[model samples]
Target: MLQNKSMIVKLLALLTIPVSHATGQVPIDPNPFWQSGEAGVYSTGMIWRDCNNDGYIDVFFSNGNDMALASNTIYISQYGSLLGTASWYSANAEYSGHCGVGDIDDDGFPDFAVANYLGTGGFSTAGLSNLYFNSNGLPNTTPDWYTGDSIYSFSCALGDVDGDGDLDLAFTTGEGYTTKKQRDLIYFNVNGALQTVPGWQSTMFTEGMDVTWGDVDNDGDLDLAFCYDDVAAAV
Candidate 1:
């Protein structure tokens, strides 16, 4: 215990060491530059990519607050440091923190599929997850397409689930506030748009917090995995 205390003291001393600041550059600390919204109070998730094609990676954060009218925000990068000249794009969303990015429009620029709910109602806020097509190096103000689903969406995965040479979407949802219709869904990519497969049946008909595509079975094809929020135990 004495040796452990000495090691901890040394670590603390190292952390307190003063870092020299470069001209006009922000010094990084042990704390992550990525911070949640509302001064680190409400946060859901975020993505880092070059949204404007300026060669500098930008950032997008989903609002974890369900009651806040503005639920999404984007920050453009300036290529200097993490903190530099950039701007924000804010929009109305409902607890929209989960998101996926891809070039759905085949425009060589990545687009977004952020998990969002439609309408202002607090009950079962799942109406349509947004599909923001890349427009002039930024996400379009209006979504190019929607999944057209009414089920509550917790998160989504965007990839080529069908090996169709393009990206597809997998939407997941969890039961919210005694909501009855919670299910996971997959939409096939067809000519830059998405469509539901005919006669396709879903085994994950219950609650799903997240979804992804992988070859867990190693059958030479991608498989979808539905992730439910639960406590994990490590052995």
Candidate 2:
């Protein structure tokens, strides 16, 4: 049926999934360096975890204040490498875009989520779709939780979905190009909290964007996948 190029690079390396949540790679330095950290490049999305756990690997920059007024940044590690940025989270004008991490409230640290792409050509960039709670270790700048979107949210994801081990958040909205109708949210996390409308919503999807969870069908719970960047508008 399909050709074979090393089985399609081993099924694309088992579907290469690593968007960062515990972070890694800042260690192996033998002259391998890569810089580019002035932070706030009008970012639209960013998430890398390890926020303050310190073992290294950190970075969080999610901004989009209408082109230039950038905010939201936290680049830790100092003696381990990231060296600079730390402090400044969603400073204002609104537009966050797509952001995510985990832990959610399991408390052992790790937490981050933000997707607020509130309309553009249709007007309405109010933006507000967040959930940041790492508290004492630094990650809480108010938003113990916030969710409300229908105009457009790019994508934000956290896991567990329904296994009951905690951590569940998945939001995606797109269709701001106009025609309307587009939804995709799934909060769900009960006992550990994170419910305030959205146990599931899907208007058949439009410009959705990112969003990913596992458990394909071995069927134990978690299962979700959304990808759409539609810019055309007409369904």
Candidate 3:
């Protein structure tokens, strides 16, 4: 009876053991540094930079949903550890989508932009975007500027398209169940501020999803490429 009991106990222990450990294979840790615990609910956009000028790379992520009963938050990292949340400049808008970082004000420090895909009510069509300037590599709660009215922004990109030595802004806009065909836009940097380039808005294709600047044709000047979400045949 004692021998039979020992055999049953050993079988139970072996069943509890994981297959990887039993097979002598080491399991890899996905979140080895505990960075994922800091991610807030509905976290979408993430970017890495020296946000505090500490020479160590930091991370930033936009938590958009209201799942935690809290407002939209931007979580920052401090040398591989989750530091804290940054004060969002726009209190009323929900930033649960794409984000980009660049120096929009010709400052030495980099600035960041967040896109408000869904508005406060969670299905609002009046989406918005905000540009927060950096003060000595730290984000300023007060935004340097914001988008105009009736603009439903989705994604943003920063580049010197005109090659004038200052960073410019390009963004995509559209929403669900809307008849208005979405298009991309470019705001040229002029004297540390963004100005909508004349006739630029009319050149975008339908259903603009994202925009980026590059010299695709090997030209000296940078060209803009807009990606669309739908396929349209040339009729």
Candidate 4:
């Protein structure tokens, strides 16, 4: 009976040691569960959206900047698989700075808009904004429309500001190498294309860097907000 009791005490000691170590402690995995190959070189401005309405989110990436290897292309991934790539404009000397997704034509499918900061023609001449409309819920490589010359676009945002059923675009711009500041633009969607809204440019004197819209006053109307790069005070 004495030997049995001693053996039982040793067993309980081992069990209690493990319980003390595990108290308030959580196990963590140290190894990576998954990995994937690099999609593109010098990639920037990545965004995920439900482009095809298949309930699975898709990804879009822009590979730009380097002239030798830069394709100035947008790569798409659907359902965790690469769905090919498309370039809507001439890739020569073009850096795809930023991109935004929205339904510009009220077609229930998300479209893509990109800002070409510096193109082959150089800063002042090559800056432009391009828009690609999604056709039949698939990614379209071709741009439906592009901004006029000398637009100098940088970052873009999409929203419905006027309570209209269609989406609108607000983009920022600035001189690439000079002190000249550019005005922010608001393009209203009209008849499946973007039209410039008059007197919508920001009156504050600053170099626009980014833009977005929200109803800040609880008035149900969307108010625009612009972020500046050189302004001393918040606007």
Candidate 5:
């Protein structure tokens, strides 16, 4: 958590330019991509975290697959400047699908988790997805996928569902076509590994797309917020 870390990031420098009267109030230039109809970057999920514990928020983007030349990237500053980036397929089959981030281990530092969907939307296959935990915030090594289904959607939310002090993860898969249609699941941390809570799959949270973790009830323990429907309806 690095509670004492500085929140203000020190900028290097800013240069000033003399203004010439091109016009009274210079007309704003329309966004080139918007005006020219150029295709923009497509991202599925992202998270804000101080990866270095330096107080600067780093951006982690996910593309959900290994296709698309530049599907996954990490940026530090604005205007598409690259800080560090990596390819997802550079990891084990245990982790090669959807990706996300959160304080999964409750060590105060944020960890990275990737859901290895294996480029498929089915759930019958085994060893399909996993989560890699970065106890430290470095991105040099491949991520670990130690939880959830690999063939279907590998989404996660962080919270303490059973009143434990440590944060736990809620996972889901099945993709809505399973015989039970019960992809919703909760993994309560036992010592370290994520162990599924009994009856978690029986929860009523079906047909959800995005799951956000927060203290909705303000009970000190984190709560859950689910955004249902598909991409268009979500937007």
Candidate 6:
């Protein structure tokens, strides 16, 4: 059966050559702020959490430099369906950098926090970067400027560092200057206003790219784990 052996060899060879076929799975393009693959558009950040407890990753997408169309567009989706989509702050403006999430107001529900770069399409224009407190699950109202605001919000984390049962927020901002020049702004909730928490600050990080919070140290106090891109070599 020489002919049969040749046919089997041919089939084996065909199988060896990597065949590429589409998975027929359409990826959910949930980021409404930036069109797919458009230049000068930033899409996602380091902050990703299971907001709906669905066991699926809820990805939040935003813009970096292109503020005109990027502002006010944050989409949250899982299972290929968009569960939440809202534009909160800096309407029709460009939002840059990263965002955070946790129950800052201590309602046992997670709240949302974002760090706006406060610049133009490039780093030329500078304005006040903002932090919005989402009291309810998602925004039911329009995203006007809130009462407590911060400028140059590069990154943020949510935790009750003081062990007060009420979760607080820790955010960082500033230029890529000295280590001390970079600052940590701790917002403690008191009577609905985010008052400052004192003495907990140190030279935690420089040029903080993203901030995450959890009980990493196992000390029962919620700790901060920040990704610092600029000083990775130093660490």
Scored by TM-score, the top model is 1
What TM value does model 4 have? 0.70
For residues 119-145, write the lDDT of model 4, one tens digit per residue.
Answer: 546553546677778877665665566
TM-score of the candidate numbered 5? 0.58
The segments of candidate 6 whose C-alpha lies over 4 angstroms from its true place after superposition are 1-40, 46-59, 65-69, 76-80, 83-92, 106-109, 120-127, 135-137, 140-151, 177-180, 196-200, 203-205, 229-235
Candidate 1's residue-wise lDDT over 51-89, tens digit each?
Answer: 878888777665443444344656665573443322544
> For model 1, what is the C-alpha lDDT against the true structure?
0.59
Model 4 segments more than 4 A misplaced: 1-41, 65-93, 124-126, 196-199, 233-235
Q: Write the per-residue lDDT of candidate 2 for residues 100-159, one digit (tens) a residue.
A: 877766767787777766533323343457777775666766577877544467668888
lDDT of each: 0.59, 0.62, 0.57, 0.58, 0.46, 0.48
Q: After superposition, which runs of candidate 3 have C-alpha atoms over 4 Å from their true positions?
A: 1-29, 36-40, 65-77, 84-95, 177-180, 196-199, 232-235
Please give the lDDT score for candidate 2: 0.62
Estimated TM-score for each candidate: 0.73, 0.32, 0.71, 0.70, 0.58, 0.58
Go through the candidates in order and give the C-alpha RMSD of each one to the true structure.
9.4, 19.1, 12.1, 15.3, 10.2, 13.3
The residue ranges of model 2 lying beyond 4 angstroms of the native Cα positions read 1-36, 44-57, 63-74, 79-96, 103-152, 155-163, 177-180, 187-200, 203-235
The ten-residue window of minimal lDDT in model 6 covers 4-13
Q: Which of 2 and 3 is ahead in TM-score?
A: 3
List residue ranges in candidate 5 displaced over 4 A.
1-42, 65-73, 76-99, 106-108, 116-127, 148-151, 176-180, 196-199, 215-221, 227-235
* Per-residue alpha-carbon lDDT of candidate 6 for residues 128-165, written as tens digits (9 for 90 to 100): 44445455545333332332433445566666777766
Name the TM-score of candidate 2: 0.32
Task: Give the per-residue lDDT of model 3 (tens digit) for 41-116.
Answer: 4555567676666777555555553222123344445554553344233343463455777777766677877765
